[model samples]
Target: MSNLDSKLPELMRQATEDLEPESVDLVERSVAQGTRLRQRRSVLAGTAAGVAVLATLGVVVGAVQHFDRDGQAAPAGSLAVGPSATPKPSLPSKAPSGPVATSPSANLKDPTLTTLKSLLQGPSRTFSMPENWGGKDDGFFGASWVVDDGKGGSRVEVLLERFKGPARCAGEPGCRTRPDGSTIRSESLSPEYSDARQKEFGIVSSHVEITRKDGRRISVASYNGVSEKGTKHTRVAPILTVAQLTKLADSQAWQFPAKVSK
Candidate 1:
């Protein structure tokens, strides 16, 4: 053998002379330590996941408890509260059933009222005067009647006054001058309201006004409702038509007393 080959065994013995020998349990200890580390990491991960689940459950239970204490609930995502927090539904109100208010002079008696009721009588029709009239002492007299036919009830009002001359037809619809030197104005299913009450009631009227040559004026109005105000509409249209109102206004029974006939 060569000299270097002969010295190799001594060199190896010198290199290992200060080193400790390998332990028989070294590989087993290494395997057990690695397994323990892996299990610990798995347990930590499982604990974090369980904490998240418990946190979510706590939030849900807290929200439900809060709602139980109060009628209103906090908004969660897009979820809304129940109807217990909302206003209750209400039914529509009915119109008043009391008599209509009027001027203090409404109770005054006028001889002219007697004649007007007689003119309104007809088959299947009944008429009654309400405490809603005035102008008995003045030259003008106004009165109203609640008339009912077999179909429904309606209000028919009449006003007898004095006019300066034949009405100027400007802006007045269906106005015409009769051959008797009288002017007549008629409206068909037209709205005429003097105050908020009449407007709120949605009153529509069929009206006729006549200005005679004798300087006396007659106004006849029919309403779709039982009264001009404080009532709902009982029919689709007024009880009397334009033609019927015109005929009523043209009657001779609307005259005042002889002294005030001017």
Candidate 2:
């Protein structure tokens, strides 16, 4: 007979002999409980083994599926499956073409001259003219709107006037007399000056004489200093020859003072 069947009979005989009449019932119940416990333990062990095998198989299947999708060979203990793979396309190496121009004048309209005129009429906030409407004068043959730094901080000016012969030095105190005995003094001033001299005049000047290509000579001078509220103003002179000045006078870039009416 089978080993398990033989053991069960011997166990039952031992139980019957060892137990009293009342205790025999309790012993039988105990033996039945032990048999149930052994059966449950065997079922649990079998379930654990099945789970381990399934987990190993799942891993192998997944590895094979990945290899098939990538067009590679399936490794041992695995099966390949899925769609065929293709190499990805490369990108272009050069820049795309379109409009290539970038200079300021490329897309802009002409008559920047007229635009300059408007700017001069309503000079920027930074450029404040003298209270007496000093910008207009008969002495100035022509003028052009240069630029202002907008914070009342800096400015550039260009003016043209007819050569009224030569300038005399009588009005200015520091004017030097030339050896020619002519009252014509070089308008150039020394860079170094005493504190007393600077305090007397609210500005500094740099002067030079330039002869135009047409044989007309003119004096060019620059005046720079602080204005009201400590704003800096710079005035440049003799920007053009008398003939050139006349032409610029008609240009749109020139603006006469409002008070002057022309």
Candidate 3:
């Protein structure tokens, strides 16, 4: 017998040993269905091959058109002729126009304005003056300036205070009081304007405010990405200081309104 015929009995024996009785019957039905499906697919493939051969011959005969040396069709002109050229691509449409208005402050490029924007946008923390009603440990409004070093590091905060007192150190032991009953302390940051000494730092932006109970308004001037010496990258400091002084001088909150000398 041929090799397939010889293996058929062994294959049947293995299948009977490996599969359950119900599974063996199911597999026999599946083999019969698969054989029918393969025969149908072969018949369909033959029909498609014959149709493709006929269609190719029809296209070859139909597409042939006689043309003169000038590329013009012959007198018969049976075949459909395509246009000589294709259309060009179109451009995008233009946007609609509207009225243009000038900015209210055309001088936004002013050095002072630019410096103020930089200070406000700098990486710094918010600061406010501590409330003072004679009951608080320090009878002064406090302000803090936060600075960030270039590297990933902790921020340095510089605290400033303004109060109704002399140059005495209140936090120090055995500190003396002023003649007017107020404590002797380091003179206010801006001593000339006692009424709004705290508000001196508000020049960079009008939005800054001082609302503590001591009637002392505190303002803050902050710098960022600075060194410990406060000298390197010092451009931001002087600008912020000058702006705060200017704002304090211009504010209505000052006790003695003084003109900015510079």
lDDT of each candidate versus the true structure: 0.67, 0.37, 0.34
lDDT of 1 by residue, 7-101 (tens): 99999999999987598788899999999999999999999999999999889978786875685655455466454433322111111123442
Tens-digit lDDT track of model 2 for 1-262: 6998979988999879865676657878899999999999999899999998998988877877787668677665566555444322211111111123112222122222233334345334333321110122443321112334442222212333333345345565534444533332233322213344444543433333332322223232223432211323343322223333323333434333323122
Give me the overall lDDT of model 2: 0.37
Model 3: ten consecutive residues of lowest lDDT: 89-98
Top candidate when judged by TM-score against the true structure: 1
Q: What is the TM-score of each predicted model, taking all chains together?
A: 0.52, 0.22, 0.19
Whichever of 2 and 3 has more lDDT, that candidate is 2
* Candidate 2 Cα errors over 4 Å, as ranges: 1-159, 163-202, 215-220, 226-262
Relative to the true structure, candidate 2 reaches a TM of 0.22
Query: lDDT per residue, candidate 3, 1-262, as tens digits?
Result: 5999999999999878865565657878899999999999999999999999989966764554333434565434366476554432111110111122111322444332233234444454332221111112433222122223333221121112334423333465423444534322121122112234213422111112232333233333333223222223322222244345334323443231112111
Question: How well does candidate 2 match the true structure, expressed as C-alpha RMSD?
Answer: 28.4
Clashing residue pairs found in predicted model 1: none
